[model samples]
Target: MSDLVARTGRLQQRYEAGCRLVAGCIPFRYRSSDETDVNSEKVVEVLMINSTSGPGLLFPKGGWENDETVEEAAVREAIEEAGVKGDLMDFIGYYHFKSKTHQDEFSPEGLCRAAMFALFVKEELDSWPEQARL
Candidate 1:
């Protein structure tokens, strides 16, 4: 079994202005168009996971815990949800959204603010915490 484990619960979750603070990453990789060509065109591919709630794909994300920096949380989410490890490149931006399921005392309206980043995927694990869910 892998030593990796996904964090759970909202015990350390951060909230601000009735919005649950979240962090996530857009994992991507460069693929060579032709292996034979010395200067082959590189194709960019973004990684996405199957959403547990419905019929859609989503980037890895979760609550931004108080114990970790937003960048740490984003990287953690990628490993937990996508079973991939990578270098977090750039800060994409913050996005706001609402989710009834995420409603809690801190976020009565389920309002969420997600800080997203670009991650250059470096490793893909054959066994990860959430691999069974994939």
Candidate 2:
């Protein structure tokens, strides 16, 4: 069994102006289009995790807690959800969305503002907190 465990609950989650703060990243890697080609073009491949509630895939993301910076939260979510670790490359941008299904005490309206980043994946773990679900 994996020793890693994903964070749960929103007791320390950050919120502002009634919007829950989230942090996430697009985990990517570069692959050579042709292994035999000396000058093969590099292709960008993104890593996505299976959604627990449905059939779609999604980037790793979760609540922005008070104890950690946005970058830390993003990286943590990547490790927890996608079982990948890497160097956080660039700040993509903030995305705003609403989720009635996610409504909670910290975010009564389920409004969320997610800070997104670009992560260059360095390692893929054999097992992670959510690997059983996958």
Candidate 3:
């Protein structure tokens, strides 16, 4: 199968219950700076991917697959969507969001829950899935 098709397949695999469950990460890196203090000397920059289906930047995220743990799923999403590999840091928290297109019989409000993680990016691909990033 084509890369795009495989990616779309992974992203579109929702739970049969219609309850949207997802995994994602906030990928970030620290750059050396001229500042003095150890804490302040590193400039932190977070990676944001251009939304393929809508406007604005977004963290790499997608549907949770039955075959993988939440952390694994989050890491997979980051690699596929942002082309970044990183250490999975602390479990940040869960976020509940709503989308008009996501509404269904099980989730009338189109509500979705995502388990978010903090990923300290170690490597960035020279060429990622073709899309804008910030």
For each candidate, the alpha-carbon lDDT, in order, equals: 0.91, 0.91, 0.77
Instruction: Kindly give the stretch of ten consecutive residues in candidate 3 with the minimal lDDT sum.
Output: 1-10
Question: If scored against the real structure, what TM-score would every candidate get?
Answer: 0.95, 0.94, 0.77
What is the Cα-based lDDT of residue 73 in candidate 3? 86
User: 2 or 3, which is superior by lDDT?
Assistant: 2
Pairs with steric clashes in candidate 2: none
List, residue by residue over 52-71, the lDDT tens digit for candidate 1.
77788989999999899999
Off by over 4 Å in 3: 1-6, 10-18, 35-40, 103-109, 129-134
lDDT (Cα, tens digit) per residue for candidate 3, span 1-134: 11432245434445544568889999999987865566657789999988766788889988777778999989988887888889999999988777546666656777788899999999987645543433
lDDT of 3: 0.77
Best TM-score among the predictions, by candidate number: 1
